[model samples]
Target: MFYDHADQQAEAMHPNPDWTTTPITPELIRGALDLETTQHGVLPHRLPARARAQCTDPQLAMVESQPSGVRLLFRTRATTVELDTLPTKRTYQGAPPRPDGVYDLLVDGRLTGQATVTGGNTVTIDMTTGTAEHQPGPPGTLSFTDLPDGIKDIEIWLPHNETTELIALRTDAPVAPMTDRGRKVWLHHGSSISHGSDAASPTNTWPALAAALGGVELINLGLAGSALLDPFTARAIRDTPADLISLKLGINLVNLDLMRLRAFTPAVHGFLDTIREGHPTTPLLVVSPILCPIHEDTPGPGAFDFSALAVGALRFRATGDPAERATGKLTLGVIREELSRIVRQRSADDPHLHYLDGRDLYGERDFAELPLPDELHPDAATHRRIGERFAELAFTTGGPFTGHNA
Candidate 1:
């Protein structure tokens, strides 16, 4: 994914736009819970108010602002559209350079094109050196032209993994906020797997995929390395308007080794309680972590396999001791049991609460065919599998997320 930095910089520095620029407003954005106006441009935040205030951990701050499921939605008659943005690209010192974040264009709900903006900003992390550096680059423009003529709904899904600072939007035809298309809002919260970690594009993320299949508007709170049943995140989810809600729990807890089984239980319960406060009857589905054989029985603090990194690759291995489980440490297996029990106990009174074992989406046999490339996150194909599976299991009739699809 190495780019010709010199060539990209030259293009970024130049100013040539045939289309008229339009000021983007809040109404045109979707999937972002909150947005902050910055000197560079608008910075989208998946977490809002109290949730943001509670996030002091650098990893949480960094990933939540990456705009994983965020997209710009508007109506336009334009034959051409261009978006200028300053995107922060990550480069691991030892691993093969990652690809430039991808921008996907959808006209009237069908993907029409894709492009990558080059050379906006850079963040280099050296695990060996235990240091990170930020090298800022000029803003780059992603242009799509010669679209079908006539009034059309245009959605430009931002890169799910990049910290994109949107500078401006230009279109040949005047643009307006998308009309209320009357879609059920679906708010989904989960770990990096749900954040589209290795998915090829923003729209291809499982949640994005499932949402399209189920015909729901999505507000994805899939924060990488941060879905640890945080109270504020619960509150943020509680406050957001959603007809259907889902909380994908487990992996991040084990990976970070954040709590023992004793504490994890109450945290899950409490997290649900907060969300129930706002939408008591919302069909809330509790999804356990998808099967990661490595963390199924083993506890984590998952660590980057340094040996693999040395060979110019990236791979992860769970480092926590299995014996630690005896001390109430969390594991995917334990979390599933507890999450199911908790949901069952609550469902008697709160019929809206339901449970879905993640293994159903990616169990042992499925893993054999579609193993996690990083030994944790799913690859693009796996994302598609999980997304389709979710749509089948949760978005189908008789499923927790099904009734609200209308």
Candidate 2:
């Protein structure tokens, strides 16, 4: 459905008398309908103001890795149609200024054109008028001409910038589909570790890397300080669709000292129950946390050891009573044991459910060889190592990944 700049111009000049009177039909709509697309941003949940400020690159500012193409659904009332692209999320310093120039245009998910703005003007394409203009302030609109005699879908690729905000999207069509069936989605939830806490590029995050490695789609639900078995998050997971799913647990639970054994057990169960509502038969993997010496077997009033920072290490201490430790209170090691037990119990009845000890992703041996930078999140090298190990363990056919046996 993409029109070249010249084609758009020619169509604009012709002024078909039937253009506005063309009949509309659903057959022309070409992308996914009733779907919601979201970005994990640079980090997971809880986007801090400072982190938002650092997203200066237009491409990296908003959503990353848009599916190759999407269908633009539209309705026709007049001789021509105009399309606009805007940012959905914004970072604030003071007042919002005009967006910068630079953008690509796509029709039916294919690159059909490009545009450059001057000052903060919007880019407009008028097919019937056979003219495209860059209007100052806000996003400009694109007009399409030469009525195809039905509803249509068009997609626009906007420049990425920290300041770019998705204000509005309009089309002559009645509906738009954002994704296609070819995209395989993998929904994942974990701690800040899964959120790209210390990863390098927006795309280099472990989930992104793993998705590339596995050649599948991804929906990362990792939250920063808020992975504490919240019902709302679990409900969000339950409502989303996925081809595969994973929950990296333990470390956050231990670090934050959210719950003890009794509560943690049922909390895990409820979380699984919620996800099962949406993905009843999809493959689901539950993982424990990687090794952190201070939180391994200890309970916590976890504190940042300033001395360790000087030496490029972090020391966390368990504040639980020694007696509590004996009884197996909240510690990474304890959480791992409980997670294993829970998975075993659940898997007996749910064939698609499985468990992966977080240690399998990164263990004592791996840590000893390359310790974490601040005793918490892994460094770039570790992210690569973890990503590789995850791909090997979870994605490879005939590997340890459950159901591959069949």
Worst 10 residues of 2 by lDDT: 40-49
**TM-score per candidate, in order?**
0.96, 0.58
What is the C-alpha lDDT profile of model 2 across 234-302, one tens digit per residue?
Answer: 776777666788899877777767777889999999999988998898888898887877788777656
Runs in model 1 deviating more than 4 A are: 1-18
Per-residue error at 307 for model 1, in Å? 0.8
- Candidate whose TM-score is highest: 1
Model 2 CA lDDT for position 230: 65
